[model samples]
Each structure stands twice: as structure tokens, then as C-alpha cells.
Target: MKQVHTRFPVMETERLQLRKIEVQDAENMLTYLQDPDVMEYYGLPPFVSAEQVLDEIAWYNKIFTQQTGIRWGITLKDEDKIIGSLGFLNWVPMHHRVDIGYELNQEYWGKGIASEALQAVLAYGFETMELERVQALIEPANLASIHLVEKHGFLREGLLRNYEYGNGKFDDLLMYAILKKDFLASSK
Candidate 1:
């Protein structure tokens, strides 16, 4: 399959744009990263400083540069301010698979921003990256996230009991996935 390394991919949907995360976005990223409500199921504790946010942004770049994954900052069509972020992680080109993750500013919750961003990223993953499967590991209690993935045609694989240890505890995660055939069939 093709790899994404020569250039960063920026995607646009009806109401949102998924672009590269930059240093200038640290403040905007910090807003949601520090929100307890936003980070509750995110596995990591709420970020407490700009330094942490910078490091997070750096990791976004690092992953892209290493050709392992990509993370895009989510912004409105007419704005550059990031309200959230999403993308593929743990990308394995040889295996044609990757794990997806995302987080939105609590203020924008229920506004369909995440859904728009997800559609764009999934298109890029399957079409451009030539991926066969995209997976998500979500906390079982994150009903909203579960609903989001379900809405996009991902099927629940099974419960991964105590699959992750984060935020000072072991957390159970529900595994979900959608293959290229599944996505294309749903698109039709």
C-alpha cells in the first residue's frame, strides 16, 4: 500500500477542515486537552500546561514524519482555531491497518463536527493510504464515541476487558473496526 510521508494531507468536509497540527495550535489544543470532561475517556489525564500541549503537538508531527501515523487539527471551514483533533495511529502499512482516535472540545459536542472530520479521515485512509482496516479502541463507558463509530458502520468486535491502564487505573475497552469493503459498501 501507499505510505503518507512526502507531504501532510489536509482534508476538508462540509463544515470542517482537518489540517496539520502546528505550534501555533498549542493554545487551542490546550483548551480541550485540559478539559476533564473531554479527557475523561481519553486515557490520559487532562493536560495542565502549555508545555504538555506542545509536546503533544510535537508527537503529532513526529508520527507523521516517521510515517507511522497522522493527526489532524480540526477547525471550521472559515477558521484556523482548532476545536479538536483526530486521525490514525499505530498505522501498519504492510498489514494495511491502523487505529483511529479523536477528541473534541466539549463546547462543540453534539454539533456533528467530529462526525464530519471522521468521514474525511476515513476516506483518506482507505482511498489514499490504501488501508484495508481501521480500528478503534474505546472505553466501554464512552457511549457517545461508541455511537459515533457505530453510525459510520464500524462493527463491534468484542470487549477487551482491562485492556488499558491509564489515569491510574485499568480500563475496559470495546474494540470496533471497519474494513475497506465495509466502508465502500456502506458508501454505496
Candidate 2:
């Protein structure tokens, strides 16, 4: 029932914390953003410098200030470094919907860290933001990501052919979504 606020919200899970991405985070983010395995599915090549990550952080803040989206840096409670980021983009207030996207360091891939971060984000999106639906547009080839969303109860609506023009050519994207009612019910 709470409304989303302009200031970044701090979210916590059992083992991770989701905080606003800041310029100081660029060095930590570069660890995964530059890793080929981590950014393999990204539309562009891996970020090569901390400056690029700074630019990205600026963009993240821009969207948040504009009330369009929010991006959070995922960090383990025991570790001081940021492992990755997850967020909602293309937010439409009238429709009460937003697109979700996320990435994690390869070293932490199998540990369920991504899931913990996502669960917190989803809760805020539905409970605080009062969103009606949350959607994910993933690359068809990214089976791991596909499975991640599916595990969280997102239903695959369909595929968008040439949905994204990335890596020099058009790529197909699998659309998945979950409504607030369904999410709340499942959490019970």
C-alpha cells in the first residue's frame, strides 16, 4: 500500500543487500561487467573501464529520478564488493507494470544469490510500488535466465522475434510475466 519514493530504498534478504548504485560502485561493478562469461548475453561488449560503469550509474540515477525505473547493486552481507545489479526499467505508471532485468557475478551463479536479490525486488515492486504486473524480456538463448524467472512463477507469454537489435544483429526475446495477484497468492 506504500507508494514508491524518489529516494533509493534499501532492501535486504537472508544473505544479501540491495542498495542504490553509486559512482563508488563502479570499481566493484567492473569485476563482473568486464567478465566475458558474465556479460556474454549483454547487447554490447563487456564494459572495459570503470568510467563506463560510472556512466551506467548516471543513467540508472536518471531513470530513478524520472520515476521510470530503479537499479540496485547486489552485495553479499559478508562481502564488501558488489556482485551485480538487478532492476526494473520501462516503468509505466498508468499500466502499473515494469520490465525486470538482472545480472550476477559468475562466481556466485549457483549460490541462489540472484534469487534472493530478485525476491526482494519483486516484493518492493508489488507491495511498495503497487505494480500490477512485472515482466521480463530475456534472450531465448539464455536458458539460465529463462529458468530463473520461471522459478519465480513468471509465465512465458510469448516470444518477440527480432525484439532486440544487439550485437550487430536482431535477436529474439522471450517475454515472461507475473501479475500482482498471482505473486501475492504464491507468497502466502
Candidate 3:
């Protein structure tokens, strides 16, 4: 697999633009990251300061430089403000696998924005990244996210008991994944 480290890859969908997370996006990113409803299943506590969001933006850049993964800020085609973010994480080029994660503003829920963004990201992961598998670890109670991945043809693998710790105690996650072959077959 070729490492996309030299330049940030920018992608576009019919209604959205997936681009690098810039410092200018901090305020918009904070808008959703600070929303309790948006952060409920995000594993992190609601951000209370711009400084925390800045650190997050920095992390996005660091991961890209390290070639560990990439995170893209989601914005409307006609707007520059970030309304959400989605991307691959924990990338293991040797294993041809990575974890997918995303979050959107509560206001954008149920509008299919996430589904659209996810479709584009998955295509990039399997095609450009040459990923064999892309997995999403979603909280059991997040029915919306579960449905989103399932709609994209992700199969439920199993429960990962006490998989992650955040916002206080450990929580369980349901593992869902889609293989490159399956994705291509479905698209065809």
C-alpha cells in the first residue's frame, strides 16, 4: 500500500467536500464536539475550550504525517464551515486494515449527510488506500451509526466486551466490517 503522506488528499461528493482539517476549522469543529448529543457516542467528553479542539486538529495533522491515518473535515460544497468529520484511524499498512470513525452535528442528524460522506470515504480506503478491510467500532446503543454501516454493507462480527475506556468507565462496542472484495462486488 502506498502511504499518502506527502500531500493531503482532498475528496468531494455530490453535496460535500472532504478536506484536510485546518486550524481555521476549530470553531466549527468545536460547535459539534461541544454538543452533548453529538459527543454521546463519540467516546470523548464534550469539549469545553477552543484549546482542546486545537489539540485535536493538531492530532489530525500528526497522524497524517506519521502515515498512521487521515481525518477529513466535512463541509458543504458551497460552505467552508465544517459541520462534521470522518476518516480512517489506527491504520496498519502491513495488515491492510484500518478503523473508521465519524461524528456530525446533531442538527445534521437524519439528513443522510453522514451516509453520503461515509460512502466516499470507504471508496477511497478500498481504492486509493488499497485497504483489505475497513472496520467501525460503534457503541451498542448507537443504532443510527450501526444502521449507517450496515446500510453500507458492513457485517456485524461480534461484541468486543469492554473494548474502550472513555468519559469515565469502560464501554462495550460492536465490531462491524466490510471487505474490499465485498464492497466492490456490491458496488457492481
User: Considering every candidate listed, which one attains the maximal lDDT?
Assistant: 3
TM-score of each: 0.97, 0.96, 0.98
lDDT of each: 0.92, 0.89, 0.94
Q: What is the C-alpha lDDT profile of model 1 across 103-173, one tens digit per residue?
A: 99999999999988898889899998899999999998899999999999999999999999998899999
Candidate 3 — worst ten consecutive residues by lDDT sum? 1-10
Instruction: Give the per-residue lDDT digits (tens) of candidate 3, residues 39-94.
Output: 99999999999999999999999989888899999999999889999999999999
C-alpha lDDT (0 to 100) for residue 187 of candidate 2: 86
- What does candidate 2 score in Cα RMSD to the true structure? 1.7
* Higher-lDDT candidate of 2 and 3: 3
Off by over 4 Å in 1: none
How far residue 81's Cα lies from its native spot in candidate 1, in Å, is 0.3
Question: Model 2, 67-111: lDDT tens per residue?
Answer: 889999998888767889999999988889999999998989989
What candidate 2 gets wrong by more than 4 Å, as runs, is 1-3
Worst 10 residues of 2 by lDDT: 1-10
